[model samples]
Target: MLKKSDMIAMALGVVLGAAATVPAFAAGGGGDPPPPPTCAKGQVYSAKKNACVKAERGALPDEEMTQYAYALAKQDRFQEALNMLDLLENPNTPKALNYRGFATRKLGHTEEGISYYLKSVALDPNYAQVREYLGEAYVIQGKLDLANSQLATIKTICGTGCEEYEDLARAIEDSKL
Candidate 1:
């Protein structure tokens, strides 16, 4: 009793319905697989081995860069730390800039050190340590006002008699004469 067009349309509807239902039935047996972890470019996932491998141009994380820079600085390898900072993809991270600045300061590169310190503070104004370092840098450069501003912030964050507080207080007193 059905017209040809109606039968054809009905057949197509059934086919489409089955097509949609088939995936639901197939998916019912097992829950969806966990999503793959995302990695930076130049990183590869080895499915057979179930591990991620770094490719030649892969970049390290900001935290790792800071740790490596600290290690190099501890070993008196300031230049190496600077080189590593230069290689980081996210070189502008506050920690990395702070480490680089600290290393440069230790190596007697005062201007470059202050530049990095300023950059670090600009990137993360809430970082108490960077503010302390900036204050110290200003003291070294004989800029009392700038140093006092930073020292006041450090004092507020660290409170009285903390190591940095004592140091900055002494520097401010010395700069007064």
Candidate 2:
């Protein structure tokens, strides 16, 4: 009685339901709520170990390093963030590329940052945060149309009320003023 399409839909539903059970951190929604960014330049706060750890390559998980790098970029420590990002074993991940773009852009390399953001977006089109950063970069380059395109994508991914959408929206607004 069931068509092949119906069976495939049911299987997909089951897989998605299982994926929904994963913890937000494990699923890359922010990663264990990183500790305060008080670690030294060569160290990163490890949530699992509950303390700072040397940021040597392979010393910590790639995801943790990527998250810390993003945090460092937020603090305007662009070079330090890039150092940490370089330590990632798999640097091509969406989060890693997004952070790299963020740090690069902050360091005044807009084109390089846009390249990284494009790679991140290619890997994960639904990643709203990357879209937001990409939109901001477009704004910086005075490309309002490209920024608006990213804004529309973010609106579809997380709606206009989400932080990514709000941040990009604010950046676009501020650009026009």
Among all windows of ten consecutive residues in candidate 1, which has the lowest summed lDDT? Answer: 29-38
lDDT of 2 by residue, 1-177 (tens): 999999999999999988886755453443436434548899988777888898889877897788788888878889999999999899999989999999999999999999999999999999999999999999999999999999999999989777789999999999999
lDDT by residue (20-125, candidate 1, tens digit) is 9788765442232323343344343334446655632234555554555555665676776676567667778887888889899989988889899899989988
Best-performing candidate as measured by TM-score: 2
How far is 154's C-alpha from truth in model 2 (Å)?
0.7
Q: Which numbered prediction scores highest in lDDT against the true structure?
A: 2
Q: Which stretches in model 2 have alpha-carbon errors above 4 Å?
A: 1-36
Model 1: per-residue Cα lDDT at residue 25: 60
Q: After aligning candidate 2 to the native by TM-score, how far in Å is the CA of 1 from where it should be?
A: 52
Worst 10 residues of 2 by lDDT: 27-36
lDDT of 2 at 99: 90
